[model samples]
Target: MKNSDSGARAGALEVREEQDPLLHRLMPSPDPAARFFWMSGADGRLRIEQCDACEYLVHPPSGHCPRCGGDRCTPRPVSGRGTIHSYTVNYQQWFVGQPPYIIVIIDLDEQAGLRLTSNLLDCAPDDVFVGMRVSVRFLARHGVWYPVFVPSQAMESDSA
Candidate 1:
């Protein structure tokens, strides 16, 4: 509501692999409607679309509001705090040289039933739990910001 998304850069994570060719090929390009969600990483914030009519928040950025059929959806910044609704430790090598990682469905604190699928970082795969507290972190590559999550305990320590 306050446009607070841009000013706070503390604890911001930058991956710095802008030249990684593999990432360039792996990450999908954001179209015009979803640009805010992907590009907000430039300022270290996470934004999702909110409906102007019914105030319903939606992800994947549909041009029209899914609930109200309103065309006035706008991107709004979120707190980026959530709980791990579910998760999996992927042991198979989806790509060569890639280590096992935990993928999670985060239930964002913003609204009920609002979830985001993201990779869990900075924690051991075996240590993850279904209700772990996580906060959003950004992985910047080739001008696209990918949202990842880390244990909220680590985030608190980093800030101190």
Candidate 2:
């Protein structure tokens, strides 16, 4: 009998945020901007740009705040609950090991335009759409659970 969860030899969705050889061998990604995003995911916390002075939430991780235009900036935690601002189902593979996936821009509640890119699970790709609600959950790999979301109505307790 052929063993399942095999053959594909491909790893989990985390590979999307894992080490990129061309960027930095020792680091997950050579790109500093992206590294922060992944690192926070590894910690199970969603961080976005924030106003250091007034502590207002911001996005795009800019140096200055749109509220005050102040250079004082800091990273802040997000609720991780959001509606599907927009999303697309990848019918074609842009790279090997990547099957058709849903890339979504989560319109976070309690924050505006603070969209973050993430993979959607627990639902079909075609089922993914704007305004669909989702909640963040972590996908564990090598002990670190990265931020991943799925369709959630209410938190369910695991019996199995």
Candidate 3:
């Protein structure tokens, strides 16, 4: 797939080895505060950090709460249902014969502003749209569970 606008800036993205070796090789840094969020997928669950004091959901787990500046936070399971806030189809061939893929920003249903950035799978680029309902699926690599989203209907049919 090629971008219609030739003036658009091309960006490099990290693709899984199981998918293809694209450009850079950067692994998730070992973060104690985010260990639960990363490893929770081992059991097929999506967990995010929540401020123990105010009960606000936090992503990219920070040890301290941004709301009340509370130092205590805990990992909580989420519904894993969300809507596409925005997305872009990457068409640059960082590697030869690399197919275009959709990267999306998802507005998680749990909270008003709670969101997550991840890849959209099992759907063609043309099929993706803003406000599309999606569900989470975890991809395990190097003991880290990376959450990827798919169309809600596709997920239901996958389980059927």
Candidate 4:
């Protein structure tokens, strides 16, 4: 089959090598930030960028902090707790096995203006809405455990 993403960034992603149940990876990104992000996913954890200088948590990496012009940074594990700020169901998809999926923008807990985009699975796409509670789940794909979100199971059971 033809490749879906042929961009440079996609080329750099870890492609899965199937040997058994565990992922066999090659040349994982050595940058601490990237390694930290991927490592967390492997462990089913979620992380956001932490500004080392000012203690501000940033969602997207920047050359300098907007809050405090400090350059130092680290990847810190987040609570995996968030609210769905916005979302969309992609009825027509260009990627395989990903059609009819929901893409969500999540606002993380505890860090002001901290948010990220990810897929929402194991839920009815039409049911997702703004301000919905969500939590992270890692889906192992192409030798990586990508961080995806779904409605919190705990919240659902509690509401029952």
Q: Tell me which of candidates 1 and 3 scores higher on TM-score.
A: 1
- Pitting candidate 2 against candidate 4, the one with the higher lDDT is 4
Candidate 3: regions farther than 4 A off:
1-25
- Candidate No. with top lDDT: 1
RMSD per candidate (Å) reads 4.4, 9.1, 10.1, 10.5
Better of 2 and 4 by TM-score: 4
Q: Residues 54-155, candidate 3: write the lDDT tens digits.
A: 998888799778889999988988877889999999998776777888899999988988989988887898999999998877666766667788787766
How many clashes does the backbone of model 2 have? 0
Runs of candidate 1 exceeding 4 Å displacement: 1-11, 15-25
- The candidate with the higher lDDT, 2 or 3, is 3
lDDT ranking from best candidate downward: 1, 3, 4, 2
TM-score, prediction 4: 0.70
Ranking of predictions according to TM-score:
1, 3, 4, 2
> What are the lDDT scores of the predictions, listed in order?
0.77, 0.58, 0.74, 0.62
User: Which residue pairs clash in candidate 3?
Assistant: none
Which lDDT tens digits does candidate 4 get at residues 1-100?
Answer: 1223222111112223231122222334556446566556665456667888888987665545778978888777667778998898877645444347
User: Ten residues in a row with the worst lDDT in model 1?
Assistant: 1-10
* Residue 58 in candidate 4, Cα distance off native in Å: 1.2
Q: Could you tell me every candidate's TM-score relative to the true structure?
A: 0.85, 0.66, 0.83, 0.70
lDDT of 1 by residue, 12-125 (tens): 654445422234236666488988888887877788899999989998788788788999998988878899999988787766866677889999988998999988887898
Whole-model lDDT, model 1: 0.77
